[model samples]
Target: MFNKKYTIVKNEEVIPGHRLMCLNAPEIASRAAPGQFLHLRCGDGQDPILRRPLSIHFADRGRVYILYRIAGRGTSRLALMARGDIVDVMGPLGRGFTLPAPGERVAVVGGGIGAAPLFFLLKKIGKIYGKKKDMVRVFLGASTLAMVPGAAQIRKMGFPLDIAADDGSGDFKGTVVDMFRKEAKNLALDRVYACGPPPMIRALAGAVGPDPAVEVSVEERMGCGVGACLSCACKVRAGEGEGFGYARVCTDGPVFDLRKLVL
Candidate 1:
C-alpha cells in the first residue's frame, strides 16, 4: 500500500446525495484490483481524524474513481472538494475478489453503493476472459430508482444487466437478491460475487448456503486503514475445534468467502 496525495480530476454528483470522484493516481490505479479499497483522509484538517474507506469504483489509465454517498460529516466534507484539489489517500489496500476459472460462468452482484467495486471487477474479467465475456452477468439493486448509482454507466458497458428496486421503481419490483434467486437457475452460474449492506449479504449467504464459489465484499466501521488498529473486525467461522474468530477487514479482507462469513 502507498500513501500519497492525488489530484482530483473529476468530482460530480451522479445521483442526489451520491458523488463520484476521480483522482489522478496512476501508481495506485495501475496496481489496484477489484474489491480493494482506498482510505481517504477526507481533508487536510484534523476534525475528521479517521480516514473513510471507499471501494475502488473503477480504475482506468492513470485514474481511480470512488463512488460515495453523503451520509455524514466526513462524506459531506469530501463532497465539497472540487476538481484540481488534492487529497491524502492510502491504497490499493486489502484483498480483492478471486477471479473465476476460464469457461466458468459467473454472476456479479451488487446492491446500492456496494456496486462500486464490481465495475472494476467486470472490466478486469473482460480483459482476462476476452470472448468469454458472455459467461458473465450483472445484477444491481437499490431501494429506489433514484438511489441506484452507476446504472447508466453499467448499462453503457453492454453486459447483460438485471436491475431491482425495492419500491418497484426499476426493471424488477423487489430486492436484488430476490431477483437473483428467481433467475439464478436460468443463469446457471458457476460462481457469484456480491457486496452490499450486512442484511443483504447475510441473506445472500443463506441463499447460496455452503457454496464455496460465492464470495462477498464486506464493509465495517474502520479506524486505521491498515491492520494496526484492529478496528474493522469481522466475525468468521473457525475450523473444527474453534468456534469463531475475528478477521480484520482492513488487511485480512474486505473480501471473503460468503460461506465462511459469520454474518
Candidate 2:
C-alpha cells in the first residue's frame, strides 16, 4: 500500500518481447511479497491517462524489479525509458501468494508473461520453506524455451522445475495446463499457484477443479490500477448470487482461489 516514487536504475531488454527494469525503491521492496504488482505512471503529466500495472518480478535489499511486455503504446513508451529515469510507482499492492508452511507440498504453474510473478514466488517460497524444500515443485510454460528464465537457475534455488512449450519445441509440447496435469498426476500437491493468459488460467481452473488450495492470478486490461475507477472489473463466480458477478481485478484480487472464480 505504499506510494513511492522510484528512480529507474536500469531498464534492459531481457527477451524479444520483454524488458526488465530495476528501480531504486527501498520501501516497496522491503514490504513486497511474491505475486504483488506495481502501478507505474509513464510521465509527470497525465497525458498517458492511466498508470500501467506491472508484475513485481524480483526485489532485493533496496531495489525492486518489474518485468513487462511491450504490448501497447504505454508499455512501448515505458520500454524506451532511459536509465536514471524517475517514475511514479504505487504498490507492492494487491494480495500476494500465501507462503508455504512446513512440509507443505506446493506447485507453481506459470505461462507466457505470467512467469514474472512466479520468479519472486519461487525465491520467497524457497526462503520460507527451504527446510522442507523437497516438498515444492515449479512448472513454467511458454511458446518456446527462450520465453522463460533459464531452468537451471530456478533449479539451483532448490525447487524442481517442469517446463513445457506450445510447439513441441521443448520438453512438453502443449499448453502449460498440460504440464500442470502431468505434474499433478505424478505428484502429491497441497497447493497450486498460477498466473498466465485468460485461456491458460481458465484451463488451469478446470485442471484444478474442486481443489481449495489452487490460487490464480487474474490479468485484465485496466484504466486504473487502483479500484476507485472500477475500470478493471472481471466476471467472477458469485458465491451466493444467481450467476457470475463483476469483481475488481485490481483491488479484490489479482490473485484468487481458483475454485471460487468462474475462470
Candidate 3:
C-alpha cells in the first residue's frame, strides 16, 4: 500500500450527485486489484480529519478511476476538485475478490453506489475471461436508473445486464436480490459476487446459503486505512464451534465470502 499524491486527470459529474474522477497514479493503478479501495484526503487541510475511503472504480496501466456519491463533507470536497488538482491517497489496500477461472460462469450483483467498485472487476473479467455475454451476467440495483453508477458503461461493454429500481424507473420493478433469486438458477451461475447495503448483503447471504462460491465486498467507516485504528472491525463466522470473530475491514478484507460474514 502506497501513500502518494495523484493528479486528477478527469473529475466530472457523471449523474446528479455522483461524480467520476480519474487519477494518474501508475503505481497504485498497476498494483490495484478488484474490490480494493483508496483512502483519500479530500482537501488540503484537515477540516475533515479522517480521510474518506473510496473504492477503485476501475484501473488501467497508469490511471485509476473513482466513482463516488457526494454524500457528505468529504465527498462534497472531492466533487469540488478539478482535472489538475492533486489529492492525497493511500491504497489498493484490503483483500479483493477472487477471480474466476476462464471456464467458470460468473455473476455480479451491485446496488446504488456499491456498483462502482464492480466496474474494475468486470473490466478484469472481460480481459481475463473474454467478454462473451454468456460467460458473465450483471445485475445492478438503485432507486432509479439515474442513481445506478456504471450502467451505461456496462451496457457499452456488452455484458448481459439486468437492472432493478426501487421506484420502478429501471428494467425491473423489485429489489435486485428478488430478481437474482428468480434468475440465478436459470443462468447456471457458478460463482457470485456482490457489493451493496447491509440489508441487501444480508438478504443475499440468506438466499445463497453458506457457500464459498458467493463473496462480497463490504463498506465500513475507517479511521486509519492501514488497520491501526481498529475502526473498521466486522464480525465473521469463525468455525463449526468457534462462533464468531472480528476482522478488520481495512487490512483483513473489504472482500469476504458472504457465508463467512456475520452480516
lDDT of 3 by residue, 119-223 (tens): 999888887776465689899998887788888888888788999998999889988888787778676778999999898998888676433299899888998
Q: lDDT of all the models against the reference?
A: 0.88, 0.83, 0.88
Point out the worst 10-residue segment of candidate 3 by lDDT.
203-212
Question: Candidate 1: where is the Cα deviation over 4 Å?
Answer: 209-212
Across 28-111, the per-residue lDDT of candidate 1 in tens digits comes to 988999999999998988898889999999998999999998989899999999999999999989999998787888888899
Error of 1 at 155 (Å): 2.5
Error of model 2, residue 53, in angstroms: 0.6
lDDT of 2 by residue, 49-152 (tens): 77898889999998999989899878888998989989889998778787777777788998888889888988988888856677887888988878886467
Distance (Å) between predicted and true CA of 82, model 2? 2.0
